[model samples]
Target: MRKLLAATLGILSAVGGFVDVGDLVAASQAGARFGMAHSWVLLLGVVAICAYAEMAGRIAAVTGRAVFDLIRERLGARVALLNLVASYVVTVVTLAAELGGVALAVRLATGVPYLIWVPVAGAAVWLVLWRMRFPVMERVFGLAGLALVVFAVALFWLPTDWAALGHSAVSGGQAGQGWGAYWFVAVALFASTVSPYEVFFFSSGGVEERWGTADLADARFSVLVGFPIGGFLALALIATATVVLRPAGLTVTGLEQVAHPVVLAFGGLGLAIAALAFFAVTFGAALETGLSAAYAAAQYFGWQWGKRVSPREATRFHTVLLVSVLLGVLLLLTAIDPVALTEYMLIISAVALPLTYLPILVVANDRTYLGDRVNGPWLNTLAAALLLVILAASIVAIPLAIGTRMGQ
Candidate 1:
């Protein structure tokens, strides 16, 4: 049971990573428009995230240094600071979206408006980060996120055409959505599933937990099992959306629409469960992004971080974390639609993909860092192929968004 609990920690991190608000919007959008056509993207993202996460965890265990630590050492202080700025911006944007998601969830459960709940949600998230033990926080949110499985349950209860969903997953046609729009959705889905904050949080969490060589196996189990489970849940979200929303030609613009499939199957109760899942996953994601912003900054500057020390002890890290949350709150106060912010975040994440990834790949191969634990020939080949895809997505993301007018 003890070993199982540790394994569960990894799964918790993956669940937090793969299903944040950006994904809640993107996955539902993909399913509603392209049906299961982009399911492969989620699967590909799962594989890619797991592989990279394993490497990051391995490096953390063996080197006793988190990803951003190695990132600074390799990319040097100046370049790493630049990476910190860009990544911090992306992480903050994502944090705002997730906080909005929490508000949306609260609004669904009660009749309160989302705006009313926004500040409340942000305060509650901040409190959790401030006082909660890290592992306990992970377990609670991770388990709550599993509530998303209700969507999968709704599928069986609803009149789902499983065979057609299978066909679409294997065949990546546009289903009349147009190739331009199809690719746009593809980029969004790719970016959400492979959000860079996941890496920052995962590697940093390993360090916070004091993972060492003996803990490598547990870390590996967590990434391999946990992230794939997250991908499966995300895949289920798309499939449910495809089955219920696509024929109506409905595109999701908010949380209510995203939860429509579940509502159709189980009415109020399903809606309740869906909302709860949204709150948990998004809230969990908000914490991760907030910390990731601070992690990137502190790691680059070679300052102390993590909760092992008190806020005063890691003053710089805590200060950055607090500021990051405030920035997210202020951004939302501008009344920009959080959903729009989420979509835009995904695109920008696509653009900055290489900055986070190239450093990891380079560090993963460093003999001094990994010793005999470096990636093998075949793993490197796969990483290269995946890197090519990431580059293509980054390069075309902007052009496609423009040409498609943000997928009209």
Candidate 2:
């Protein structure tokens, strides 16, 4: 039972990276604009994240180190510092976007202005990080995030054309949207799926929990089970949008639009459930991204970090966490659109994907780290192939975004 509960880290990481505010916008935009044309992209992303996360979990369990720790060792301090700079920027921006999402969700539920909730959400997230047990924090939000299954439930309740949805999934047609726009959404959704912070949080969580060789099986189980469940929820979001929003020509510019299909299916109750799910996933992601920003900074500097220590003992780590959340709230206070911020966050995440992933692939195969536990032939092949895809996305992300004018 304890092992099962430990899976919440994976669940939280998956939910935060795969289905957070970014995915909520990107996935629904894909479904609304291009039907199921990007379904294959989501599937590919899930496979990539699972493969990389498995290796990350294994590395942490065996070496008692997280990805950034290995990165500094393998890449040298100068190069790893550069990597940390880029990663920290991306992660802080992601944290800002997630805080915006939490505020937007609050606005959806209470009809209050989202800006009013920004500081409230930030303070709450920081408080939880300060006082809560790590596993307990992850489990609470991860389990509550399952409220998103309401999307899948609403699909069955609505008059979904299962056959057409399946056909579109296989067909990969762009539904009159240009190829540029289609690929734009694909890259955005793909970036959300394999966001760098997910791996950072996953491995950091393993280290924080003191995973060892004995915990390897439990970590693997969590990555395998938890991430795919996140992918399923993301797919349900796509399917719901395809059924309810595509025909209406809606483009999902806000959380409200993302919830429309469910609203259509069950009215007020569905809206309430969708709002709860939105808040849980976004708030959970805010926690993950806040920790990830701090993790990268601490790991790169070789400072002692983790929730296992008291705040005074890990003052620097806790300071970074507090600052990251504050930065997020401040960013939202500028009154930027949370949904738009998420779009920009996905684009930046796409460009920075390889920096975070390449180190994992290299270290996962290094016998120095894992000894006999190194990635085997099949995992290596998958990791290598996924690396190629990630590189393609990175190379093309900016060009696609510019060419499509942010997917028009």
Candidate 3:
């Protein structure tokens, strides 16, 4: 049962990575505009995230320290501080986008105006972080998020062209949409899949739960199972969009449009499920980004952190958590479209990918930290190869966004 409970951390992390507000928009848009042309990017992202997250989990388990804790020690204060600033800014922006997503999800379920729910969603998420136990918080939202599987079920109910999707997945193309736009969307989707906050939250959660060497198998299992499940769910989103929205030449302007395939398959029942899934994923991710922002700050400053202690004891950590949530609420109250905010956030995240990931690779290879448990040759090779891809995405993200006017 303990092992079973441990899986929820990966599930919640994957929920934040693959099906969060940004992914719902990016994945659906990929399918709608270019069919499955961007499928390879998603697959690549899953591989990269799973590999890095495993390294992170192992570091937490073996060293009895979180990634950021080691990062500061290994890379020196200057580089780590730069990474922290970039990561923190991007994470807080992500938190705001997620808060807006929660409000948007509520508006979909009820006819309430979105702005009215922004603060309400912020308050609810803050309360959950303040009151909920770590394991229970992870388990509840993680399980609820599986409701997105309805999109996969919709694939069978609809007349999906399986062979066509298979062909598109392999024979990647720009679909005459210009390579600039294609690559822009690819970067965005990749950024959504391997967001830095996911790793921050994953490693911190390991520390929060007191994982040790004995828990390595459970951590690996969570990484192997949880992220692939997220990739599959994300693929279902792409496939559904390819089947329904692409054919209709529809644009994915909002979450409701993203759910249209499911709605077509089961009508009102599908909408209900999609709404719940949206709320679960967005709300779950809000908790993750909120905590991740706090964790990164606390870890960097060498302040006391984690949920293992009382709020009064971890005053600085809890204060950062509160302030982050308030910032999210304030950002959302400005009424920026959550989907648009997600696109911009993904672009910035893509540009900052190297700052977050390169240090992980360096730390994972350092024998001082992992000793004999350090990454093997094959994993290092693969991780290095993926880092090059991350660098390329970072380099081209802005140019592609500008050339394509944010994918037109």
**Top TM-score model:** 1
- The TM-scores of all predictions, comma-separated, are 0.98, 0.97, 0.97
Q: lDDT (0-100) at residue 311 of candidate 3?
A: 92
Q: Tens-digit lDDT track for model 3 on 78-111? A: 9889888888889999999998888888988897
**Candidate 3 — which residues are off by over 4 angstroms?**
1-18
Structure candidate 1, residue pairs in collision: none
lDDT of all predictions, in order shown? 0.87, 0.90, 0.89
Q: What is the lDDT of candidate 2?
A: 0.90
Maximum-lDDT candidate: 2
Query: The CA-based lDDT of model 3 is what?
Result: 0.89
The regions of model 1 sitting more than 4 angstroms off are none
- What is the Cα-based lDDT of residue 25 in candidate 2? 90
Candidate 1 TM-score versus the reference: 0.98
Preferred candidate (lDDT higher): 1 or 2: 2
